[model samples]
Target: MTAPQTAEQPVYDPSDPSVMANPFPIYAKLREDDPVHWSPSLKSWIITRYTDVRDLLLSDHLSVNRLATFYQSLPPADAVLLKDIVHYLNLWLAFRDPPDHTRVRRILRHAFTASAIEHMRPNITEITDLLLDRLESGGRNEVDLIREFALQLPAFVIMDLLDVPRDMLDDFKEWSDDMAVFIGGARNSGDKYERAERGCRKMSSYFAQLIKERTENPKPGFLMDLISARDEGDKLSEDELIATCILVLFAGHETTTNLIGNATLLLLRHPDQLAKLKSDPALIDSAIEEVLRFDGPTNALVRVAAEDHDLHGRQIREGERVFVMVNSANRDPRIFKDPDRFDITRQQNRHLTFGQGIHLCLGAKLAREEGRIAVERLFARFQNLALDPSEPPEWLDAMVPRGTRHLPVLLNG
Candidate 1:
């Protein structure tokens, strides 16, 4: 991990929606202008250099538990959301760092293996087909790519993985949407809290019943497997299990939903690449990698300094917050061939979309499957697909991730 120096002033202010709206340019400027800077808003230094972000990610001196730092960075009101919701429950692995992260992660690790996801391939294929059936049934109408394909696939796949019945699919989606409010676009303060609170209560109750039932009469499923697995003698606590389930279901749905939507929009934006993919099909994997490289769903992650140390020369005080911009690193010219353009055939492509180190996204395999299959099916179904060129995409730039809220596309059979 290459360390970098910085001044007391912030490199950039990400809280501004305008900056968040199109941060690539700003990120590019930051990497060139001031790779390391302190933000008055965040009160934390920003690290934008591709090498620096990579170094900090793998460095033992930094911990992913940036809860305290994140709270301070937020406006007083926004602090409530971070402290109350994102921090309190400690549901997911992304929030944890080091030994515990390794411990808790080991239990659920087996379930996310390639073979485990392989068992789900047939089901994912079926769900993808069923969704497209609904869209095509409508025929020639203005289709919202986000709702129809992006949101629908992940919701069902995650529900099915957790052995959520075929019946409560709608309920699952509603719960996911509510939970996503804090992170996704158009988050209403009242509505976000209301929805998240309601979701937390409902999901906790529902999973409690499931956990109890599995305890009494265990089945052969993800929920059952997770419950059964124990390290030495210690097992994941009830809250941990519930929180873990919530993380898997919610995180699984959230990022992949945006991946499909963003990929679709970007592909049409580059018609030649789409045509190349449509013609060759072999390029889809590389294309998928590039889509994430170009504009992955997740913007950045929060980390805290675990020790007072020097990064590239500047002193990083212990407990200070750091926002590691993964998206910015993906576009760094030092790592990538052409940092900006969307080139499907670009060979030496390795983007940090799933993040890095011990905290790399767990469900990346499943997400990639959904993205690959969704694009394949979509291009196959619609011969000539293009943006409703006139109508602009409704962009959703929220606190959590980035993607269009609604992308209306004209699909021709």
Candidate 2:
């Protein structure tokens, strides 16, 4: 009888294409051999297992307040600039812990109800339709879907949601892009960090101005809602309101943009699944779910251990950062049978794409709806949607919400 051979362990490198393009093999090995291994490269513990990841996310012992510690670790001069950046991040709902997270979430939920998202479907559909039409008007047989369609759809939707003036659309996108690059920890050179700080300062000032104007004129939007919303007779502070706006504006569209682009490219690569989707357009929802599980927009989230603890036979100390590999947990063989293969019709597909626990994405439902509409409308409009032979897909170096930089596709009738 031949003995079973073990898979070689891979060094952790979040930006490596080998890891980004296909992290399952590495994740599988880690899950089996070292589920709670610490990575010196990341300076954090990497948790990669369906059960462990889910449990840690739900555990109150860990915290999302690790950013402050990170900022403090920077050089003195950089810390000054990072202080201004972290100021806004500190107020973000995603970066808060305990009582603050509980309070802000309660207030924020009032604005993002399912009914509100459903009501916006008509507007979302209108935006998607218009963007698709714009794609064709350029008089080109090939188009970069990432730039021409996927990117604009979510930005416009967010603009509409926030009642942002149409004139400010370009500025908003620039700011959001900067935020994503900075937050995703991609291309983190000194110049890049400076650019992120400039973006943070500009957005902070812009939102502050908007809040001041809205205070007197009043408006119908998420910003306005946050302005007026009260929790136990406590309304959001001016700084809090500005921070929340920045958080939602960036989080709202960035993930969806990646989701649409990633899902479309996935479908283009897997013709069998694409044929299935085209054959039964109703499967768009399930197909979107599958793409999310297969190659989710987000790869991991960092949480800090609150105290010393033992997990899966490994000891973790207080204040140490833990990187929960959501992308890995979704593909755990224990949970999903034949997890490597893409099957849109897979039943009971419980993936951690939107994450779980109290911090689950508030925009999950809306993002899913947008992905569904984008896929359905694109396939319906173009009979032939294949990757452009001239330009291959360029995956972004981002680790958090990984996706293509541009996806040029041959769009033929």
Candidate 3:
């Protein structure tokens, strides 16, 4: 990597919330100064270029193992839980690497196959239409897209996939939100902590009941599929079953919701691209890809160096934690043209929103499906949709997640 003549600031903290809000400029400078500048803040080198990021992912030295995360820190179980929570923020696939990753991922393989997604098309469309009905009834009065549509929308689809009762969807949403807080260390010490604890307990109990019921009498949902799936006396243990179910429920709803919200906000911001898409609905597929590229819900992945290794000529001892700024890598000018612009028709976009390598997201197909349908149904319902003139979508500022809390918008009825 060529080191450009960029001045390195004396202090740049990756952990700082303000920096997390927009880390690109700092990333640009870091990539110039060898895309692997060790941050005093994190005490780890940040990899900012696309090639280096991909290279390190495939490198034998960098380990995405749970033990790797707590190499210098927590107890094994606690470390495992922490790493699980870290990936759980993106619903936990982010924690596994190689063998262990390959093992658990198998249980979910058939769950999200292309054919599986096709089987799901009916329910997905139903959910979209149901939401569109509510929006149409909402009348000319401005509606908060996040609250009225995007936020609640994914929860329904996820509930359907999990065969979870509709009444519990609201609770699941709260739990996932609380989990996000815990992951970022942004939770309030009291109410937030209590909420997260309760959420965990409730989720376990809920899935436990479903597991029991599914065992007694199988059904046609994914939960039932898991209950029936057997491989050489290898079935998901009780805890593993609960954990995996929680993982799916939280993942299926939250991240896709954020993706839809992000894409909608981007479209509103870039009227030309929005107009182009509306003029040609066929662009919806690529538009979702562009949205995943322009600003993914996840900004980085926490990786631990598995063994002592050299990164950019600097010795990184085993167990050292490194945060791969995948978000920054996706925007490298070397890989993307005007990388920051919102171009709906952008071809050759291979973004890291779903991540890469062995730990890549399983729900990615489901997410893109949800995104395309939501936007398609949304556009179909609202003809002259524009930003709610008075209030554009304001981003929810948090360290781990990037999305809008409420997207207020107007529609020509």
Q: What's each prediction's TM-score? A: 0.88, 0.95, 0.87
Candidate 1: where are CA atoms >4 Å away? Answer: 1-18, 68-88, 166-170, 181-195, 312-314
In model 1, which residue pairs have backbone atoms overlapping below 3 Å? 1-55, 3-312, 4-311, 4-312, 9-38, 10-38, 10-39
Determine which window of 10 residues in candidate 1 has minimal summed lDDT: 1-10
Q: Which candidate is the best by TM-score?
A: 2
CA lDDT of each prediction against the hidden true structure: 0.78, 0.83, 0.72
Question: What is candidate 1's local distance difference test score?
Answer: 0.78
Which sections of candidate 3 miss by over 4 Å?
Answer: 1-7, 10-21, 40-44, 67-93, 184-195
Query: Per-residue lDDT tens digits of candidate 2, residues 1-413?
Result: 11122355445676677676667788888888878877766777888999899999999768999887788788999888777778989998889987998888988887888888898899889999998888767779888898888988888888777767766878988877777777876743446677778888888899899889989999786667778887678778889888988887788788898899989888888989989988888888889999899988888887899888889767788889888999999999999999999998888889998888888998999999999998889988887878998888887776677688888998882
TM-score for candidate 2, please give it.
0.95
Sort every candidate by TM-score, greatest first: 2, 1, 3
Error of 2 at 288 (Å): 1.4
Write candidate 3's Cα lDDT for 1-413 as tens digits. 22222354434564555565566777777776656666654566677788888777767778766343443365665544444333333224556665656666776665556887878888888988988788788665688888878877888887877788888767787777766565443413445445555567667778889888888887887777766555555655676677788888776776787898888778877889988998999999999998888888766666777887776676777777666777788888999999978898888998877777787778888889989999888877787777877875665545446677778887662
Clashing residue pairs in candidate 2, if any?
none
Best by lDDT: 2
Local distance difference test, candidate 3: 0.72
* Distance from true location, Cα of 52 in model 3, Å: 1.6
